[model samples]
Target chain A: MAVKAGGFKRRSGASSDIPSSSMADIAFLLLIFFMVTTVFRREKKREIDWVSAEATRKIDEKRKNILHLWIDNVGQVWINDQAIADEDIARVVRPIYAQNREIVIAVRGDRDVPYSKINTITKQLQAAGAVRVTFATRLEQRLQRPRR
Target chain B: MPILSRKQRVSDEIPTASMADIAFLLLVFFLTTTVFNEEKGLPIVLPEEKEEQEVSAKNILFLIVQPDGSVTVRRGESEQEQIVAYRQVEGILRQELAANENLIAAIKTDPSAAYRHMINVLDEVKKAGAERISLQMVGE
Candidate 1:
């Protein structure tokens, strides 16, 4: 009887490992969720080359109030990644102007492009009757060197 | 019977000792593949064409841009137009701007000029705290 009691105690005390085989599956599922939701925002930043400016105010307006136009380093004009000719800028801008009278046409050009391309774009915007057109510039140090 | 039970239990466990390693490998793969947001630009409005009144050259500052990225600033109150470097425009315009708050800097950029230089001049003009700016494209 004593021996049987001891055997029963030892049997009850035996340790068993917790199951963790599903850990890889859980982690893989989470990784897939993140991968699908990840957005690089590639349209604006790729090859932009924004020129740095000083004492420039922020773009205070809401995203809905502005139309973003980007010019690549190679002089290719794009609106939301759609290629549009310089001459057709007005056609694209006109209707948006009609819908929202307070719309601002913001021109973002690459630092390496020529002024001629910018001129053509702005002129087209004007012809499209866009009253508010602005150039986009990156920020730089505001304080100047002290006077001698 | 004992041997068969032992073999069955070992096969049922699924060999999960390497599970943590596989999870870490997948996590690392995702971490390396993430994309982050970048910086945006500061917006400024161009002057209205309908409000284009004929102001004499003496009333405005002219920043002439050449194809080689050189800048020439013409002051509002003075008739003299001097070829200035990009760095000098900021201090020069700032002093002149302090004296007169209503000064306007007109950018007469040659179409052949590099676009980066025009933006540089615009930056300096804004740096000087001038409120009114006009851009006119010159030379096709």
Candidate 2:
């Protein structure tokens, strides 16, 4: 916040009395700004147990550009938050890819899932022409500084 | 009259000294509760479904993920297709990838194998910088 120069200017060597009384107003303004801009998001029930990948890259694609495939611990497949039969992935993915060919397929599989389930999903994605596939993993982070 | 007016002005002023405190409280709350949904992943291309190409046996690296989270590795050129233990995958793939740039790491696993096994194999392949990966269902 820009303080009013004229109000805080020193007068007759009374520099010790420089005005800081408006700091409270500035703080309140910033508080109100954040309160107005805060977004409250809902929790998704389909959060999978993600494995950590050291080679993973942070995804920068927008929400609209992603098509998600979820594989649960039981190997059940879910698309767009709805559980889908294993064979139905190709059918469901066709129209979505037909609408936008630029969309990237994000495969989120549970840590305990089977390889076949993921293979089927990627196969369906290939059939749908969604060649860009990414597996979601939590990036391994180094929390502590290494002692040299 | 002056004293009464002074008392009235003092009472009229709003005490806003706690504004910074209140703002800090909110900032702390947000800092603690904010869930950063940033996720990361190892990316791969899903090639278009087409007729299987007859790749030379020398250019393939076969990997099998067992149901019990064990991996079996084999060189594509071997006639007998000997399966090695899962733990040695990284070293074998690393040496193979270094030797052949066009080597395809083909992963086939039983349906009963857990997903974790597949990811582990894929991770090692990625670390080895294998140029291509083929994922297919293994028939019983």
Candidate 3:
């Protein structure tokens, strides 16, 4: 019986440690899954000169709640990658406001654009019943502030 | 010769003990380095359409921006206008706001004025911590 017990000890030589061979495969699978599921934003970047401000703040609203309205230096307005006429702004934005009541219009106007163009856009936004607005600007450092 | 034959019989599997550590290191590096492009701006709420409220003229502070980028400050119910550089607007508005808590900063920009000129004045007014702000266009 003692000889059989000694022989059984040889049969019980299975590894007590957890197998690590598949760990790399699991991590690689997660990495590939994240890479596949990630959606990249592909908005075309407009090259308008950004206005800088000392009072610039980060808009804390969610990405979905904010809408980008770009006004180029020539006073041309662009929304959602489409060039929109000044007269048609309210019409275009009304439906979007209807779809999402919490939509905040982010006016990314060029610094050289006339104030009248911005005024007109604000009026159109008011007509569309979307009141919350943000003027997107770069943060200006106080050291480089131009003295009048 | 027997040892050389035994060496040839060894297992041919590649070792992967540290693969998880290497992958996790890469993941941590990417996670720390990835920067999201966040939205930034000066936030303001516009009044609803046709929702004009009658504010007393004494409670209004006019900041008239010209096409030349100069600012003309005018108090409500006063004919006197003070022309100052855009940089001094914050100091002027801060003093006025201290005396009158219900003061409204009415920024009237010329139609032909560059947008930055208006924004400069607006930034100063906002810096002064004015709660009631009205944006208007000249000759509108």
Mark the regions of model 3 whose C-alpha exceeds 4 Å error after superposition.
A1-39, A144-148, B1-15, B21-33
> How many steric clashes does model 3 contain?
0
**Clash count list over all predictions:** 2, 1, 0
DockQ for the candidates, in order: 0.35, 0.53, 0.49
The runs of at least 3 residues in candidate 1 whose Cα sits more than 4 Å from the true structure, single-residue gaps closed, are A1-45, A141-148, B1-39, B76-79
- Assess the local accuracy of residue B32 in candidate 3 as a C-alpha lDDT between 0 and 100: 63
Clashes of 1: 2
lDDT, candidate 3, A16-92, per-residue tens: 98888888888877777656655456567799999988899999987888899999988899999999999999999
**Residue-by-residue lDDT tens digits, candidate 2, A70-119:** 88777788887688998888889889989988888788889887666677
Candidate 2: lDDT of B41?
A: 84
Question: Candidate 1 residues B70-126, lDDT tens each?
Answer: 787777567776887887887887776777666677778988787778888887777
Measured over all alpha carbons after superposition, the RMSD of each candidate to the real structure, in angstroms, is 7.7, 6.7, 6.0
TM-score of 2: 0.76
Q: Is candidate 1 or candidate 2 better by lDDT?
A: 2
Q: What i-RMS does each candidate reach, in Å?
A: 4.2, 2.4, 2.6
**What is the DockQ (computed on Cα atoms) for candidate 3?**
0.49
**Comparing 1 and 3 by lDDT, which wins?**
3
